[model samples]
Target: MSQTNNRDGSNKRSRILSSDVYRQRENQSSTNVAQTQSGLIIDNETALSSEIIKEQLNSVDDIITQAIIEVPTKHLLYVKELGDNLFVSLSTKII
Candidate 1:
C-alpha cells in the first residue's frame, strides 16, 4: 500500500502481500498419468482395462453378501417377513 524509494532515489511500489486472490500454477509433465509411446496417456493401467475393472466389480457383490451373512445375529434388532424374503434392521449402537 506504500511506496519505498531505492538507494538510487527511484520510487518503487512495495507489495503488501494481498491474499484476496490466490493462484496455483502446475507443470504439465508432473501429472500422475504417463504418456505412452503411442501417445496414449494412462493413469493406473489396470484402472482403465475392462477385464480388470470387471474382475474388481465382480467380487463386490460377493464381498457385500458375505459381509451381510457374517453379521452377528444379536445385531438384528428388528425383522419383517415379506413372502419368502426378509427385511432386517441392524443396530448401530456402540455398545
Candidate 2:
C-alpha cells in the first residue's frame, strides 16, 4: 500500500472529518489544472496580441472554464472508493 507523510515527516496518519468531500474537491482541482494547461496553447494561439493572451490566461473565469472542461466524470467513483477506505481505516482505529 502507498503511504503519505505529514508536513513534519512523521508516519502518523490523519483523518479529516469530511474526507470524501475534500477528496472530491481535490480531484476536481487537479482536473482543472490539467484542463487549463492543455487549453493554454489553443487559447494563446487565437489571441490577437500577447497582452490579450496574457490577460485572458489570468482571468478567473477562463481558469474555471478550463477546469470545468478537464474534470473527468470517472473521478467520482474513485473518490468514493477512497472515502470508503478511509472510513474503514478510521473505524479500525476506533475499535
What TM-score does candidate 2 get on C-alpha atoms?
0.21
Q: What is the lDDT of residue 8 in candidate 1?
A: 28
- For model 2, the run of ten residues with the poorest summed lDDT: 38-47
Clashing residue pairs found in predicted model 1: none
Consecutive 10-residue window with the lowest summed lDDT within model 1: 16-25
Look at candidate 1 and tell me the lDDT of residue 66: 33
Error of 2 at 83 (Å): 7.5
lDDT (0 to 1) per candidate: 0.46, 0.53
lDDT of 1 by residue, 1-95 (tens): 13333532332222322221111112344366666547777774434678878889888765575334455354453332332244243454435
| TM-scores of all candidate predictions against the true structure | 0.23, 0.21
Model 1's alpha-carbon lDDT is: 0.46
RMSD of each: 14.2, 28.4
**Best model per TM-score:** 1
